[model samples]
Target: MDFEDACDIAEDLQFDLSGEELIDAYRERADAMVPGEPGRAVFLGYLGEFLAMAGRPEETRCLRGGGA
Candidate 1:
């Protein structure tokens, strides 16, 4: 998906993943996803959200590779 779409998903995740521990849990879940699967978007989306939650939005943007 696109950066904007990823950000939107991340924003939505803020409700359920409101704290650092929760966000880290989500990150671990995302990390467990297999590569080259349809879930990649979901993984990246969560990763982006985690970075943002962890005060690293720039890293999230960079991880997205472009179009942020």
Candidate 2:
């Protein structure tokens, strides 16, 4: 998946997905997605926010490259 596609998926997952579905979206395309460093950071930030909203702060912290 390209950056645009990743962004699209992120946008969808941001509002609608949670738990396993959000995880599945990332796992499905992580190896294939090739967004740049900035893009990757932005995507991760989005994912972190999503995880937080989903009541998964530990996962969000991991996404933020932080320790528990």
Candidate 3:
């Protein structure tokens, strides 16, 4: 799905996500919907942005380390 469609879905979810978090969740859903697709990087980038926006950049970094 495109960014606009993702944004719409985020809005419908009513999660009170900031713009970055909304994009992040959308990317996560999109990536999950289509595994091994070329869009994974896009989703990852949005996830990083969301973490940073939420002041949880360390969590994001930790996730990249293959551990919880």
Candidate 4:
């Protein structure tokens, strides 16, 4: 799916996920995107930034733990 679609999904699901799970879900979606696609890096970067802003350190830690 495209970045915008992913963002929409994230927004829709934000309330349903634990902060950590939300970040994990976004990271998974970002990773599944094809490399070199326009906005791929930006999408992932923004998700990471958002997670940090949301104080989701456990989520960020899991992402890092997965080596993404």
Candidate 5:
């Protein structure tokens, strides 16, 4: 599926999605969401989860306090 479709399905298929799909979904989500304080923290957590889902624990490790 395309990035748009991947973004649409990333949530339900989080663990099942691939690297590019997860990355695209990550960017898609960061663009759509990313509020302040609590919401930002939550978004970062989701970002880490997305990286993990993409088999990219390295990227998550580099993210300080889940920051972008």
Candidate 6:
């Protein structure tokens, strides 16, 4: 999906899900995703940023990654 879609979903997730519900929904979507090409990596990056900014009052589900 695109940045706007990701942001919209994040907003929905924040509003509707929490704890196990959030984690399960995240896993369901994540497991069903198609791997993007390298050029499309930026969208994945923006998704985490949007999730962080989406105001999840329960807990943050986004994790961090860095250079090996």
TM-scores of all predicted structures: 0.48, 0.53, 0.48, 0.54, 0.45, 0.49
Question: Which residue pairs does candidate 3 place in steric collision?
Answer: none
lDDT per residue for candidate 1 within 2-59, as digits (tens), equals 4465456556666666667656655665566565545556656677766787798787
Q: Distance from true position, residue 66, model 6, in Å?
A: 11
Question: Can you tell me which runs of candidate 6 are displaced by over 4 Å?
Answer: 37-68
Scored by TM-score, the top model is 4
Better of 3 and 4 by lDDT: 4
Give lDDT per model, in order: 0.64, 0.63, 0.60, 0.66, 0.59, 0.52
- Candidate 4: list runs displaced more than 4 Å: 38-43, 54-68
Number of clashes found in candidate 4: 0
Better of 1 and 5 by lDDT: 1
lDDT: which candidate is best?
4
RMSD of candidate 6 to the truth, in angstroms, is: 6.4
Candidate 5 residue-wise lDDT, 1-68, digit = tens: 33444344456546766567656665565556545534344445667786787688877887654535
Q: Please say which candidate is ahead in TM-score: 4 or 5.
A: 4
Q: Model 5: which residue pairs collide?
A: none
Q: Write the per-residue lDDT of candidate 6 for residues 1-68, one digit (tens) a residue.
A: 76566556755775887765665665455445666633234334434444556664222343344322
Model 2, range 1-68, lDDT digits (tens) per residue?
Answer: 44676577677774887677876665444434464543465466666665677788997776556955
Q: Clashing pairs in model 1?
A: none
Against the true structure, candidate 2 has what lDDT? 0.63
Candidate 1: deviation at residue 46, Å? 2.8
Off by over 4 Å in 5: 1-36, 65-68
Clashing pairs in 6: none
Segments of candidate 2 deviating more than 4 angstroms: 1-9, 12-19, 26-36
